[model samples]
Target: MRPPDFEARMRAGECFHDVRMLPAAWAVLRLDGHGFTRFTGRRYEKPFDAAFHDQMIAAAGRLLERFQGLYAYTESDEISILLPRGWDLFDRELEKAASLSASLAGSVFSIACGEPVQFDSRVWLGARDEDVVDYFRWRQADATRCALNGWSYWTLRKAGRNAAEATAALHGKPVGFKHDLLRAHGIYFNDLPLWQRRGTGLYWERFAKEGFDPIRGVAVSTIRRRLKVDRELPMKREYGLLVGRLMDGAGSGDSRRTA
Candidate 1:
């Protein structure tokens, strides 16, 4: 129904703001729950909930499988997925990449939890492998800080303090003060589960599989890779070491080509 000139004008206007990620850089998509505090508070337990954790894991697994991600890290209500430098999904369009990641995460989580949920996504580009490692390390540190604060705040709330009171109590308090506050109530932040503090990371690991080849009439061994989920992540420098090793392996695999 439109004239030829109209179609041309529409295309020109629409493509003006289209932005793509740099082709040589790796991409990381970080998705965070939208208004999940109220959403989960009414449906699950406080501070930490096993059911919520399970749902997040299920959704993360689905994303990793669907996107062919190199790695995924989740903590609290946030997930970070690492995409290889050569990935060209949606032609690496920034808007498409962010929207699709958020949509996939929200849909998967909602389906798994049987409740409507939403997530917002942002893309981070890294020019070097070390940048990726540092990004995750930064996120892991944030997870640790959030875990401490959550435990401390919820402990006060459970003891009859309202939200305002809990917030006021934690206001301007140093990390040591928060630790002491939790310790006074018989809770040790360090004693919490590693996943609760350091968050969970998922990556692929290669393993050998033994199988029988009927046509060849012989037993065969194949090297196959599968996702490895690590809940008990190491802390600080050790965690950085782990991330570095994973990045190194991925880089090596990316560089190798079979003719």
Candidate 2:
């Protein structure tokens, strides 16, 4: 409908903003909910909600299946997805990867919750395996801290304090103080559910299934794989080791598929 040079002019103007991740580097896409504080306040329970947790796991599964991600970890309203070093989706374009990841996750969660929601995403580049391990470890630590704070804040609010008063009660308080505050209310932070403290992990696991082949008239076996959702995640070095094993297993599967 326009002149012949119209398309060329538009392309030239937008081309400079195209940026890509470095080749051969691992990519971790972290998606965080936008305005979820107000959104979830009326629709879900505080501290932890089982229905919301299930929705998050379902959304994580969708991301893993759609993006070929190696793993996905979710805590609260944020999800972090791991991609292999060799992945080249969307030619590693930064804008494309970030936008699509956010949109996909947001759509899945919104549909499951029966409400409109939005998520924003950012990519983390890991130059080596250790970097990837550290990235997850850091996020897990954040989850623990947030879990503690959330329980404490809500406990004070339920007792009689308003939102601002409850927040001020925790400001500048050390971790131990927060724990003691909950202890005073008869809640042991360590005794809470594992998923509440450590976040949830989703990945693929393989198994062998035996079947009878009618055409061949014999018993046969084949490998099968499916998505696994882990709510009771470990801590510290143990979690790093678990993630390392998952990465190794994914690499082995890739090799077999190519061969």
Candidate 3:
């Protein structure tokens, strides 16, 4: 009945429950909004909302700053953070990383939106740089697919189709069908903002800052790092290259449209 004996007995119950991220591999922490569909209804514009987008970006930025992530990507209701191979946050405890990150992101976004929100987080492991590149490419593809379906569905809804009707109309439709549906409504799918299709990316960049050297009575420039939010990300092979460069520590100064 001693306190130390009770503590040891309780610890034994968690022996196989806790998991850790592999130290030699890259860890991508992906946080997804829970129950956002019901939450966003009537509160945000259909398909997309600029204010909500900004809130997501704010949450992603906080994650990057707190964890020193190599890169961050957000689309729809989810954000994915890329942690370097050597990252040792929480001693690479998977549960700690996921729980704390989800809580932090939910808190940051809730404060920004003036309403409580929740995100569920998970850790993805990549064994190599190419694996990392492929993972992002996959996510970008999912973004574009979701964008297309969203526009198509919203177009129908605005044109008098009910929720069930809109869902049924595009349920078994092909990609071409969705594209044509949007085009018929005077919305060109390809011409839509790149961020809608490819998702937004955030990474650190170094830039020169000018300041007065008061002690020496002279103006001096120094290098500083800032988190760059990219809205217009590249596609396909180019997108892969961007991820590769980021993993290799050459992401700064890459050309892209920003918000």
Candidate 2 segments exceeding 4 Å error:
1-4, 250-259
Ranking of predictions according to lDDT: 3, 2, 1
TM per candidate: 0.92, 0.93, 0.93
Stretches of candidate 3 exceeding 4 Å from the true structure? 16-18, 212-219, 251-259
Among these predictions, the greatest lDDT belongs to 3
Q: Write the per-residue lDDT of candidate 2 for residues 1-259, one digit (tens) a residue.
A: 4776898787888873578998999899999999988888888889789888888888888887788889999999999999878888899899888899999999999899888899999999989899989999999999999999999999999999999999999999999999999999999999999999999999888766677778867776766777888999999999999889877765225211210
**Looking at model 2, which ten-residue stretch has the lowest summed lDDT?**
250-259
**Cα deviation in Å at residue 1, candidate 1?**
10
* Residue 164 displacement in candidate 3 (angstroms): 1.9
